[model samples]
Each structure stands twice: as C-alpha cells, then as structure tokens.
Target: MTRREFILAGLGLLGAAAAGGVYSYVHRPKFGELPSGDRLKRMQASPHYHGDHFENLVPVPVMSEDEGGHENRFVATWKFLFGDKKGLVPAHPLPTEKTNLLALPREQDAVVWLGHSSFFVQLGGCRILIDPVFSSYASPLWFINRAFAGSNVYTAEDFPEIDVLAMSHDHWDHLDYPTVMALKSRVHHVVCPLGVGAYFEQWGFAKDSIHEEDWDTEIKLSATLSVHILPSQHFSGRFLKQNPTLWCGMAFITPKRSLYYTGDGGYGAHFKVIG
Candidate 1:
C-alpha cells in the first residue's frame, strides 16, 4: 500500500480498538450484579468514594513553581520515566510498636504509617486502618521478589479488633489477600471505593460488613465520625489489564479532627483543593 494509505489504515484500527475498550468498560458487570455465592451482600456506599474521573487517565497539571527551572527539568522527566519504580524498594523498614506506636491506647487522635500507604489511625475512641499492607512486598508473586526491609510491627494477629477498615483501592499492595482474610472476622466495617468490595466478598467477608461508594460519596460511621471520598490523581491495576478497578484518596473527618490519606497518588491540584 502507499504510505498515506497505510497511515490511514493504522488510524482506523486504532479507532476501532479504542471504541471496543470503551464499550467493554461501560457494559462490564458491576459488583452488585455479581453472584453472592457464600459471600455477604454488597454495601451501598463507601466513606472513601472520590469520583469516576479516573476513567480518563489525565495527568494532573503541575505548577510552574513546583516544576522549577531547566536544572530541575531533568528531575521531572526522570520521575515521569521512573516514578513507578519508587515502590520497587520499600520506603522504610516495617514499622514496629516503638516506631509506629500503634500498641498504645490513645485518648486523643493519632495516626501511624504502617508501611507504603497503610496507616493505623485512632480517633474518638475508634480505630481505623487505611490500605493495610503487611506483606513484605506489594506483589501477587511473593516468592520471586519481596518488600525491601520493614516488617509489620503488628501483624494480622496483633491488630486490635478494628472499628473501620478503609481501603483506598484494590491494588495487591493495598488490599492484601491474607491480611484481609484475617481481618474479616474482626473488623466491624470494610469501606472501599466501588467494585473493591467484590474482592472482599470473594474472600469471605460478610456482605453487611462491606460498604462500597462511588466518587464524592460520603458515609457516616458514627455521630462524630464521617468519611468522605475525595478525588485522587492515580490509576489502578491488580493484574496485567489496567483500570479494571477504581482508585481514590480519603478524608476522615471527626468532631475533633480531620485527616487526609492519599492512598497512592501522583501529586495533583486535589492536594491544594483539600488544603
């Protein structure tokens, strides 16, 4: 074929592929539609549903000040190239009771980073965990590669009976299989973005215990505790197929305090909007 004709044919194929992908996503079975089997029923909403804009994977705008000058230009370019490699090595050692202070009973509000994006938060006599990753590395294939250094100060065995478990997304690192299964019997509620609860239900968590939410939705945990799903600049994937699931950050607001958990996100205007 002539060069121009070849280019036209390639463009047509690209358009066809894009149209097929959109059609599949729009018609895919939602979590509620899936068979319950032995699993519990699905929840109506999650405290951490941010929004559906994640369907369009647009990079958040970077500010000029944050971008810096030509000298720093390379930094931005390098990050764009290798940013996903950040989690290749563990950021810090697995937190211990001394390091995370999770063992202490707190009368006031407190928050501790478990590792990666997992956090142990205590507020108003209630304990909540966000994206609790306890495994050495955030990977499905654990034997070949593992997390760098840190060990969980508290394992699934050590976790107190939690009032709320807020999962930001369904990435293996954030939503561990073994960890969630262990917490299933003890956790009062599992709040997650839409479709994530399906994973828990499949894992045997009670249907009444799993609550899923769409973007910008809110859930009242108690009279004094509320969780709001906020927008995040990020993508999600557990297996090779990308964007099969949803992702978001969370804002936990209590009568006495407010905290934001950016589960795993690229820095974006959403931070400034939250501030």
Candidate 2:
C-alpha cells in the first residue's frame, strides 16, 4: 500500500478507537445523577464541602510536580497501565475459609476479613459489615479490573441480617451495585459518608435506612453502640467527577471497646488527629 494510504488508515483506526472509548465511558451510567437540587444544596452547606466539591481537612496534593516542574499526564498514565504488578495478586488458588456469620456467637466481639477492604464485625451485640464488594469485578464493567480467583468466596447471600452496613466511599471496589441490591432487604441501617446515600436511594433503599455523616460527626447506632465519623485524607466519586461526596474513617465505640477502621487514604496528620 502507498505510504499516504497507510497513514490515513492508521488515523482512521485511532479515531475509531477514541470514539469507542468515549462512547463507553459516557454511556456506562448516569454521570450527573450523583446529588442535585436539595441534596447538593445540603452538601454545599457542609463545612468540608466547598461550593463545587468536598475538601479534606489538610490540603492533600494528589501528585507532586517532578524536578522538571511539569507533570506528564500521558506518560504517568501509560506507566501505571503497564507497571510491574508483583505480589499484587496471588499466584495460586488461595485457601478459602467460610464462617457462617449468623451462627457466630453474639456474646463475644469478633472480626472477619473478607477480601480487599471488606470485613465483618460483631461487637457490642451488633453485627456490622463494612465496605462490602462481593461482585467478581471492581470496575464499571465486569471483565476489566477483576478480583483474584479464590479472593471472592463470600457473596451477599452468605451474609446474615446486617445491623449496620457502613461504606467509606462511593468507589465501586468498596460499594458494589449488585451486592448492595442483594443485601438491601437484609440490611437494616446504612451508614456512609455524605452524598453516598444518594446512590443507595437510587437503588431503592428506604430513606430512613440510610444515615449520611460528614467528617467528625457521631451517630448513635444503638443505646450502647455508637459510630464516630473521623477524617481521612481521601476523596470520593463513582465516575469521572471526584470528591462530589465525602470520604472518611470510622470509629466504632461500644461500652467496653473502641475499634477504628481506616478507610482508603494516604497516611497523613489526620491519623494522629484520629488517634
């Protein structure tokens, strides 16, 4: 083929690829449905929530400028796309252990780690589940960004009735769509960061079931059990626009003990503050 013809063909292919990517991204879900009207006005009133988006206590820079005094977005993204992933995933089938959550003794406090950031905690006579993502994949599409084999042993069906379902953010890895839909009937109270409850409301959860809180706010889960929403140097959003919601750490305080869960974030002075 002629050189000009080859160049034209290559350009055509690149254009098609770019168009396909844009179409997939825009059509994946409703982008602007996060929180609007009264919900957005309420979030705007929060001290942490700036007029446009939520802000962390301490100013956190996402990425530092290099010695060259410029950030190469394309090069950085390319490196991340093809970086070495050693130890990020298990090489073989990991050993699986299943504990019937309903059968566990309720008198004593216990904690079970269910892959990634998910966990089960029984404390102060309350059964709490945190950051559950039982779906096979953690991305908008199931085929991409999948969980490792054997890492997803537990499903929504395996969980017993949950007293408190706490979510730190709106990221798909922490808050899954299918799993939440499945557990909707079984979950009594939903505790999550500000603006996160909007997603639950979209999924048909009763407004009374969802309790949204800002940083450093406290909510009484029961007469003897309480939860304090602490600060974490993190941001939140499900789609392209970020920090539309607040992300936070949580402290579960019972009569006898206090347990802290550090939601996903960079290490910062907020840890000391929380301590």
Candidate 3:
C-alpha cells in the first residue's frame, strides 16, 4: 500500500475500534446497574439528594473546581489522559508480601491491604472486607485503570468467610463486579452508601443481605461492633448518570479500638463532624 493509504487505513481502524469500545461500554455487565424503585426512593429520601443527583456536604465537583473556583479541570484531565505520563507510575515493580489470610485465627485482630482500595480486616472476631476490588483492572473497559505489578497478591479465595462486606461507593475501583461475583458465596452481609446497594442487588446479591444507609447513619453489626457511614466530599457514576448513588467513608467502632477508611473525597468540614 502507498504511504497515504496506509495512514488512512490506520485512521479508519482506529475509528472502528473507538466505536466498538463505546458500544461495549454501554452494554457491558461490568458497569453494574442503576438505582430504581425502592432503591431510588431511599436515595431520594436522603438529605444529600438534590433534584437529580446526590450532593456532597460541601458541594465539591468531580475533577473540576466548583462555581467560585476557576474552570481548569478540562485542561487538567486532558493532560492527565493524553499528556506526558512521567512520574505517573512507578519505574519498577513495588515491593510486596503475601500473607496467609485464612491461616489467621479468628480472635486475632489484623488488617491486610490488597491492592488499590481493597482491604481485609479481622476485627472484634469478625472478618470484615472493604472495597474488595480483586480484579486485575478497575474500569468498564479492561484496558483502563489497571493494577500495578505485584500489587494484588491476594484474591477472593484468600479471604475466609466475610462477616461484613463494606463498600464506600459504587466506583469501579471500589466496587469491582468480577471480584464481587467471585466472592458472592463467601460473604454474609453487605454495607454501603444510600444508593450503592442497587449495584449489589443487580449483581445477584440478596436484597436482605445489603444494609444501605445515608451518611452519619450508624449500623450495629454485633453487640460490640458497629459501623458509621460517614459523609465524604465526592461523587459517583459509571458509564451513565452522575451521582445517582452516594459516596462515603466508614468508621468501624469496637469496644476498645476504632478505625476509619476514607474511601474517596476531598478535605471538607465533614471531616470535623466525623471526628
């Protein structure tokens, strides 16, 4: 082929691939489902729910400045995506260790970080998992948001029976569909923000197994164990609507010890309130 023909053919192939990607994103099961019926009703009942979307306690826009702030998020995002990516990733594989998670005694208190936002914690005799994204990547499209080398040493099989599966939001990073499907048989209960339970339910988890609540609401897990669904300054969406589900942080409280997991957000007065 001529040089000009080769370039034109390459452009056509690129266009077709982009088009196929868009179609896949729209139809993929990994994107999860949106809130409806009772789920939407509960979400709308939340004080943070505005006309069509959930609002942060301080109204922070995603990847952009709010009304009074300058509008530079578009440029920043473009630079983030297609610009020079130096320092964006580690030059070498990160150091890692694999712990025998199932071998730990039930009474022993422990916390294990399993790449990105996933965690496994043995607290107050309960095996609690949070933001359990064990998938290799974290997006509707597999090519995006990939995990780093050696970062994910643990898998669903590594976890014992989970007493409480707490999710902060429905973002792809925090709520991975493949990981959830893999862990469905082992988890007993699910906890998440206002509208996030819809995703769990759509993924075949029993509705009774999910404990969805608004921010500042506290859930009693056992006599001595509780979780506070705290407010976070963030937003949530998949390929569809924005902020249809709420985002949050979590505070696990025991009689003698306490821990907090800030899922995703910005600095805000809600932090003071949570403290």
What digit string (tens of lDDT, one per residue) describes model 3 on residues 1-275?
Answer: 99999999999999999999888778667777788887788788888999989998775656666578888777886876578868777888889988899899999999988878788998888889999887778887666777887887778898889999999988888888889999999999999998888888878899889998998899997898999999888889986688888999999998878989987878888788778
Instruction: State model 1's lDDT.
Output: 0.68
What's the C-alpha lDDT at position 228 in model 3? 93
Q: Write the per-residue lDDT of candidate 1 for residues 45-119, one digit (tens) a residue.
A: 333323322352355433233433434555665774456665565567655454435456866578777766778
Q: Total clashing residue pairs per candidate?
A: 11, 0, 0
Compute the lDDT of residue 137 as modeled in candidate 2: 87
Candidate 1 TM-score, C-alpha based: 0.66
lDDT of 1 at 161: 79
Which residue segments of model 2 deviate by more than 4 Å?
Answer: 1-32, 82-87
True-vs-predicted CA distance for residue 227, candidate 3, Å: 1.3
Q: What is the full ranking by TM-score, best candidate first?
A: 3, 2, 1
For 92-160, candidate 2 gives per-residue lDDT tens digits of 988879788878877779999998899999998888999998888887765556889888899888887
Best prediction by TM-score: 3
Q: Each prediction's TM-score against the native?
A: 0.66, 0.86, 0.87
lDDT: which is higher, 1 or 3?
Answer: 3
